[model samples]
Target: MTAQRACGLSDLVQDEARRVEIDGVPMAVVLDSNGEVHAIGDTCTHGDISLSEGFVDGDSLECWAHGSAFSLRTGKPLNLPAYEPVPVYAVTLDGDDVLIDPSVTLDVN
Candidate 1:
């Protein structure tokens, strides 16, 4: 897996979303309510709005532009206005650093 340094762990707190662009691909590194770090496509599938500007609850991410929610781990659409699943990247914690593999695709579907 190709890893990129997104941000430091201190930059992300529990239940928060942080926006970062890597290699021209915009993405969000979210710390869910479960305190897990998830990297997902920052753009909402239904629109051009940034999912990083949305709300984070557990493993679900809510799009602020349309209220559509997405699963952080699976990148699945969980509500109306969004039928396509966003792409999710893999995240690895290396000490205090946040390492993300933006090119990694989910094997499921």
Candidate 2:
């Protein structure tokens, strides 16, 4: 599937994550302090919590339930309790829009 507009760029705050659903796929869209946008699976592997409801630190999104920090760049959890990595999606900036394709997940190493 092609990229679809997830949200407006101006709607995101730095170091914050916004929960968005594209084609029924739940994702957490974050705007880092460096002014870059990222999209990852919203569900925490350790728990059934929403990652968007968690905290954003540097390039990671921490699960509020068990403190499992997932890398915004690779979607890998940095601590225990979450062994599975979330899916990271490609973000496209178009003017004031943040575009993402739910069917396309980045193969981050």
Candidate 3:
């Protein structure tokens, strides 16, 4: 997988997220409380809404529409209304930049 620069490290603050379109895929790049970076599908599995528009609490990413929080590391839904997991992409930190490979996604298996 090729890593593409999504945003500058300074652009993304702690416990915040940014919505980016990489390779025609809508991705929500988030910064967690652990100071690590994560990427998940911007669209919530439960409904047609952008996860980037939601809020980030620690490692839990919540949907703005119906309040569903998903684990940042696993993309596993932590609450009801969403049973299936969303696609999570790989993330990398290089200097003061955050990179993500939209072409790569977590295998449900």
Candidate 4:
């Protein structure tokens, strides 16, 4: 898989989400409350709003526009207004660098 550098680990704050674009695909990279990193499609499946602009509630990211909460790990919508799951990318930490592969989705079957 083609892994691209998303950002530095120091660039992210715990429990906050950041927007990053790799290969023209917008991604929402979040540092969860547990200090783990997750990467998901930035756009909300239920709306055109960016998930990066949303608030992080525990392991879920809530869409600011419609209040749809998406799981950080599976990219599945946890609450309604959104039924479809967003694409989740595989994240790799290379030293202090945060790398993401947009071509490799980590969603559960």
Best by lDDT: 2
Runs in model 2 with CA error above 4 Å?
A: none
Best by TM-score: 2
Give the TM-score (vs. native) of candidate 4: 0.97
Query: Per-residue CA lDDT of candidate 3, range 1-109, in tens?
Result: 5989988888887898789888899988888888888899989999998999999998879998999998888899999898878899988889997888888887644
Across 47-82, the per-residue lDDT of candidate 1 in tens digits comes to 999999999978888999999999998999999999
lDDT of 2 at 31: 98
Candidate 1, clashing residue pairs? none
The reply for model 4, stretches above 4 Å from the true place, is none
Cα lDDT for residue 20, model 2? 99
> Which candidate, 1 or 3, would have the higher lDDT against the true structure?
1
TM-score ranking of the models: 2, 4, 1, 3
Q: How many steric clashes between backbone atoms does each model show?
A: 0, 0, 0, 0
Predicted structure 1, TM vs. truth? 0.94
TM-scores, all candidates, are 0.94, 0.98, 0.92, 0.97
| Ranked candidates (lDDT, high to low) | 2, 4, 1, 3
lDDT of each: 0.88, 0.97, 0.88, 0.93
Q: Residue by residue across 1-109, what tens digits does model 2's lDDT show?
A: 8999999999999999999999999999999999999999999999899999999999999999999999999999999889999999999999999999999999998
Displacement of residue 99 (Cα, Å) in model 1 is 0.6
Cα RMSD for predicted model 4: 0.8
Better of 1 and 3 by TM-score: 1
